[model samples]
Structures are given as C-alpha cells and as structure tokens.
Target: MQNSKWVDVAIVGAGLAGITCGQTLRQSGYTVAILEKSRGLGGRVATRRLMATCADHGAKFVEPQGEQTQQLIQQLCDRQLLQPWTAPIWTVDAAGTLTPTEPTPRYVAPEGMTAIAKVLAEGLDIRRQQRVVEIKSIDAQTWEFTTDSGEALPLQARSLVLAIPAPQAVPLLEPLVAKGLPTAVLETVRKAMFDPCITAIATYPAEQAAAWHRVGALQPLQHPVLRWVSRESQKRSMPGHEVCVLHSTPAFATQYIDAPTLETAGRAMLQAGAAWFPGMEKPQQLQLHRWRYGFARSPDPMLEPLPHAKTPIPLVITGDWCRGSNLESAVEAGVRAASLLEQWLNSGHD
Candidate 1:
C-alpha cells in the first residue's frame, strides 16, 4: 500500500548532515523525518566487529581543527561518548622508514564510532533503509519522496533537505529542473567532485600485533597502493586478536572502482601494507569496502545563508561535499541547510 506521510520537513540521508539538519529543525517545533538508505548511521564514521575485536574501517579518529569542532568534541566528551586517543601518529616512507609526527589531540568513542551518531540521533524520527528513488514537487509548498522498495509509503514535506553525496543527489534533482527547480542550484551541485577509496580490514594473532607497541597509526608517503594503515588495538584496548584497517590510495581505488570483484584490489592493498607492518599480508579474516565518493576533490562554496529570494521553494542541498570532506564540514553544512530552509518557510515562501 502506498500510504503517505506529511511533515514540516523531510530529509534524505541520515548521515551527520541529515541528522544534524533534522535535529536543528525539530528544535523549532517542526515535524521532521530523516530517511537513511543504509541500516547504519554516521556515514563514514563506521566500525565493524571481527573475530573477538573490532576495527574502525572508516575515519580512524576525530581531530578538532576549529572552534565549532572543538566545542562538539567537548560536548561528546562530557556526555561520555568520546575519549581522547593520545597515541602518536607516524609517517612511513615507501621504503618503510618511520618518522615521528607532531603531537595532536585526537578523539574516539570507546563503545564504537557509530555511538557518536546514535547520541546525535536521539529524540529524532529517523527511518533507516529508506532509499529515496524519486523526488517530486507536490505544488509549491510541498515535496514528495518515493522509496526504492514498495514496502515503504511515500513521504511528503513542506521542505526538503538533501544530505546525501553530490553524485547520488544529482539524479533526483536533475528532473526537477523542468518543475521550476533552479538550474544554478543543480549546476552548483554538479561542481562538487569526489575521489574513490577502498578500505580493507584485516586481523592477525594478538601476539603479532602486540610486538609493535611503539607503532600507533601509519600514513604512507607517496605509496602507489596503500595510503593509510591503522592499528586499531593501539588506540583502544581489545583482546584475542589485533585489528588493522587499511585504506588504498585514490588512484588505486579508481583503477578498481568498476572491477568485477574487489578481491584483487583488497589483496593488493594488504600486500603493499605488509612492507611497513609485518603479518599484514596474512590475516585470520579479511573484509573489503569501497567508497565511490570517499573524499571530495572539489567542494562547493559555503553559502552561509542560501539565496532564498531566487529559490522556487524550501529545498536545500547539503553534504560534506558542500564545504569540505570532513566530519566538521558535514555538520556545518547541515546547520546551514537547516538555516536556509527555516528562513524560506518563515519568509512566507512555504
């Protein structure tokens, strides 16, 4: 049955951007719903359990560079959702020469990385596994969203916030140009570009990983295949086995982005990493993940307040790509997007 729901605002992509936008709107007494395509939250702030231990496959740690990010970290720490990872970061050359890096503050979640998203998602109406396939303007004041599966009912809202990746958001927004959607908005979204990334999770015997107590995390310098390798156990205490997460260079990911299978790419990354970290070539278990839009090559300019005067309706585009490809960028974009939609509605445009 294609039932329908009406809300003050509807958000696509329950990543930090969508969740942040929804939370911001809900605080103003607006009925909002966040639809997520995946079962998990936090987008790239993800973690996975393997064998007795877990590995942070996505962003290894959070380093607050700005005041806003620092404030966010302090809040999370106060709530016990975040803790400082005082481990040292080192740089490794192609020939496996390790050099010490300057000390910096990095934070992590003891429970898991996704815990950060869970806390931010509190008291919000978040619907997971809701893949939005189509978007339509239902008159000037309302927008409708159709899910990929028939099990979900269509959602209608007075305003819409697209918090997904630029590449994914383009398809849904393209057809709306004929329906009064601004070509400039679509063109701005198109200006954003991303580089692909391939991540591999590997686990080895606990004894082997314990041997490298001096090693924290390694950033490969000018490596053709491997870019980063994280020793998961170094930051957090885990038992039974040692976990390592490897990230491939953008060039490597581009070459294997459309391959029939990623097994070859995964193995190549692990093999390349073995040069710096022994036993990486052999693992008890291995898992592979591909991020088609991993890092932004070019990000859209940060529009503090969207130009609502020229917009046809209360719709805003937002994502990490709207600013930069970091967690802070996503949060900031969400806040700006929410501010735009709120202004549009309050100005009697809704």
Candidate 2:
C-alpha cells in the first residue's frame, strides 16, 4: 500500500466501542479513521430534541459501577452537560396496579443522550455517512476497504479492530470466512441475540401535566409497560415542564415487532398511560423510538477474552452484548477493547 493516503487503522461503526478504540489508538500516535454508516453519532445513546426541550429516546439514564465509567460520567458532569435526577420508580403488575420502589438517582444528559456521543467524538477523525461495504486484506501488511459509495479506503496497519455488534460484524467477515476463518469466532457471532425495545416520548399541555404527576409513579410493574411514567420536566437537564418518557416492556415490544408503524405503537402506549391519569389530555408532541438491537438477553462473557490469530486482524468486536446491557457495560466494553488492542499492538508478537 502507498504511504500517502493509508491510515494506521480503520474503525468500522462510530458507536461507543469504535469511538473509544479510535481515541485510544490516536493517543498512541497511530493514524486512525472512524467510519460511521449513520448521519449522527451515538449508536444506542440516541436523544431527540423538541420545541427547545431535550428528551432521551434511546438510553434513558446510566448507573455507573466501575472506576472507568464513573470517571467518564464525572467528566461529563464537570462539563455541565449531565445532572442527577431523583424520582420515585414504580413497577406495574398484570392487573395494572402501581407499586412504588426505592428511589435511586438516575443520571441524564442535560443536552441529550446524543451529547454524550458528540463529546466522545470530539477531536477524533470520524467520517460520518461512510458505510464500509467490504474489507479485504492486501498481502500480510495492508488492508483495503470499499465503501457502499464505491470509494476505496486503504489502511496500512500492524492491527485492525471491529467495534460493532457481533451479528453485524459477522457479515463483514465473508472474505475471511471464505478463506476459512476460525469456526469458533463464526459460531460465537451466530449464537448472540439482541432483544428489542420501544421507547415513547410524549409532551402534554401544562394543564394536563399536573393530573399525570399526581399519580406520582404510574403503572408500578403490572402492565406490558415496565417503567410506566417519568416526568421529563422533573429531570434536571430537560427544558420543558410538560414532557414525559415511557419505556415499553420487552415482551410487548417483541409482540409488536412487526407493527406497521412506530407512531401507531406510540399512540397506543400514550392511551394506556392516560388511563391512570383521569384528567390527562392528548399530547401535542409524541415520538416513538424502536431499538431493534436493544439489549443482550443471554451473552457469552468469555467473548471479550477470545484469543487473536497469529497474523492478528485489527478487528475487535465489542458492545453491551459482550458484557451486560446498560450504559456502563457499553463504556466498559469500549475501554476493555482499547486496553486489549493497546496491549496487542505493543506485544510485538504478530
């Protein structure tokens, strides 16, 4: 490969794992490029803004556990982009009765969940809307990738990494598979399954907001909706005082997996929520978000520590599935991938 245009590494998918890996490699003086198929960043950490109010349509909040995730959260908070929200949580039973639970503070981004991804992508060489169609190794020292737009991007590196989900990564390995890539890797990818979820965000009038809030916590784990109602206005960073977000139960989401439109499903959810609030009126701003690859149900914990090949591919697959479903798990997978890749690059053991 020619030296003029070749990068040291090419990261496919600008999700948490890809962004973290790019950041790590760049800090180590490696020329890296991130290819994101979507127009914006934040694969699962999606946020939507409406009429000056910000609501998280993807990941609602994060519960930090480890030092790395906690540190990341602290840095975001220091930037004045995130805040802690304390609200009584509830679980609805089958009979549609509400039951309040212990109040645990949930942290949310003031600007939105997408703000988190934007923060991470800062100063990184991320090429948005560049969809990588195929990856082929050119000799033992270089790799070439062709985009869906018929553009060729070549990388000359000692290593390469794939930070996308295992299922998404499998199709890209067709060339390697044809050349007889490890069966174990293929099998592991095939065995992984992601659960689906639907999130609904609705904005009611000020007059109706009080009626809904009176219930305190709606639907305490009885219906198809697990977490029934959260006052978006009560959230620290949310701008409006009339918005609310409702997350549907995984079972309900699966049942409606083939729903013709998300708007229909969202409308149905809003109707159900209104039942608990007697005086609740129709919402003005309603949106539905479908997470096709929401979370991992049962995953292989050992996938992260999988051994690399003798002629190691820079490809490393990481996501919430590799560990557990949550913001912390996503960050952990990213940090872990970075650490492992850093060690591999320094080992001199090709």
Please identify model 2 stretches exceeding 4 Å from their true place. Answer: 1-4, 154-158, 214-222, 225-228, 236-241, 258-260, 278-281, 298-302, 306-312
Candidate 2 per-residue lDDT, tens place, 220-305, comes to 46466545566667664443347777777777788776788887777777777776755333777778888777777646554666
Q: Model 1 TM-score?
A: 0.94
Q: Summarize candidate 1's per-residue lDDT along 192-240 as a digit string, tens digits.
A: 7889999999888888875567778889999899888888887677787
Q: Model 1: clashing residue pairs? A: none
lDDT of each: 0.82, 0.70
Model 2 lowest lDDT segment of ten: 306-315
Write down the worst ten-residue block by lDDT for model 1.
303-312
TM-score of 2: 0.88
